[model samples]
Target: MPDLLTDRLLLRPWRESDLEPWAAMNADPEVRAQLGELLTREQSDAVVAGMRADFDARGFGWWALQVRATGEFVGRAGLDVVGADLPYTGVDVGWRLRRSAWGNGYATEAALACLAFAFDELALEEVVASTTVRNVRSQAVMRRIGMTRDPADDFEDPSVPEGPLRACVLYRKQAR
Candidate 1:
């Protein structure tokens, strides 16, 4: 995928040097809380490898989110086809930023760009995003990006731990 530029972010592929900070973010409890599990450095490397391979093979996946002005790695935002049993399948929009990058509209900005990529570049008909019932912040971002809830499409995420089926809220926006 081509490197995407926003006002403050540079969306590009992952680099070998990004592992340390990425692992740190993955190890952070608060960050991991939303993601369901904390990853060790080895696990983080495996993830980076998977992401790199996905991009090479599919031409698109999660791109590393970096600060354009400072050249700092903040987090990642991009398109993904989450392989979980649910009502819908195919490309989905998602993002995850460092705690310091939160509340700065970076998520919304980067995500809107990704949506544009999906609808325009990828020629997708629609994109979907879902979060745990308790993840209000993500849900709010979904609404901010003009995605609407589809209650009938909601279901338990099989990839998540087997406990209480956390109500997964599915939100989607159609391509124009």
Candidate 2:
């Protein structure tokens, strides 16, 4: 997939150099609060590898987010196919930003771009997003992107172990 350029962010494929910062971001407790347990170095490396493979094979996946002017890797935002066991089965938009990048509106900006890519470039009928019921920050991003939430669509994420992160809320937007 072609790299997406927003006024302040660049969404592109993962790079070898991103591993260190990516691992650091994954290990941050504050950042991992909503996502899951902190990831070890090997686990973080594996995720980067998987993202690269997915992007190569599918032409779209979690693209790395960077500040265009400073060329700093802020985080990642893009779409993924939800696992079949989940209540929702479709492409889902998601994002992860470094703790330092939080409250900067970067997630909302990049997410809106990915939503357009899903509907316009891929021609997907709809895209969904989910966050732990307690992840208000992510829920805010979903709302900022114009996704609607229905409590009835929410579910306990089957993949997440029974914990604070298991119960999730689903939000979705259909192609306009």
Candidate 3:
């Protein structure tokens, strides 16, 4: 997939250099809270490896996000198949940024761009995003990107342990 650019961010393919910071970001407790667990460096490395392979085979997956002017890796935001069984199934949009990058509207900006890519470039009819009910921050990002939540579509994420993270909220946006 071609790189996507907004006024302040660039969504592009991952680079070898991103591994260290990516691992650090994944290891952050605040970030991991939404994800339900912190990832080890090796686990984070494996994720990057899998994403790189996905991009190689599919032409699109999660893209590394950066500050275009500074070239600093903020985090990743892009499209991917919703791998787990859920009430909805198809391509989904997601984002994660360093703690320093939070409250900057970067997630909303990058997600909107990915939605455009999904609806226009890929001609997909819809895109979905889900987060634990506790993750109000991510739900806010979903709302900012014009996704709407339907209570009827919400479900417990089977992959999560039965605890604070198990109950999930789902949101979706249809191409206009």
Candidate 4:
């Protein structure tokens, strides 16, 4: 897919240079708080590689997000096909920003761009997002992008080991 530009953010494909900071972000305890355990360097690079492959195969996946003016890699934001074992199946919007990038409105900005691409470019009818019930920050981003949630849609993520992160809440936005 082509690069998506917001007023302050650029959503583009992963880069080779992103490995170091990406690994650093993944290793941060605060950044990993809602996602999962900290990942090893190999594990982090593998994620970027997988994102590149997924975009090549399907034309859309997580984009390596950057600040347009400073050209700093802030984090990642994009869509992924929800795993089939989940209670529901659909494209899910996601973002992972560096700790320094938090509370800067970057996630909301990038997410709105991705949501527009999902609806306006790809013609998808809906997109979803889910996180652990404790991940209120991500849920706030979801709401900021106009996604809504139904209490009944919340379910346990079987893949996540029993922990605070296992109980997930689902949110969705429909094409307008």
Note the Cα lDDT for every prediction shown: 0.88, 0.93, 0.92, 0.94
User: Model 4: residues >4 Å from true position, as ranges?
Assistant: none
**Candidate 1 clashing pairs?**
none
Which digits, one per residue and each the tens of the lDDT, describe model 4 over residues 40-145? 9999999998999999998899999999999999999998999989999999999999999999999999999999999998899999999999999999999999
At residue 89, candidate 4 shows an lDDT of 90
Q: Which sequence of candidate numbers ranks them by lDDT, best first?
A: 4, 2, 3, 1
Off by over 4 Å in 3: none
Instruction: State in Å the error of residue 40, model 3.
Output: 1.1
Candidate 1 residue lDDT tens string, 1-176: 78888898989989887899899999999887767778999999999999999988988889999988899899999999868576678788999988989899999989998998888788999899988877889999999999999788888887777754356888989998
Instruction: Please report the TM-score between candidate 2 and the true structure.
Output: 0.98
User: What lDDT, from 0 to 1, does candidate 2 have?
Assistant: 0.93
Which has the greatest TM-score? 4
How would you encode candidate 2's per-residue C-alpha lDDT over 57-121 as one tens digit per residue? 98899999999989999999999989889977999999999999999899999999999999999
Q: What is the Cα-based lDDT of residue 72 in candidate 2?
A: 98
Count clashing residue pairs per candidate: 0, 0, 0, 0
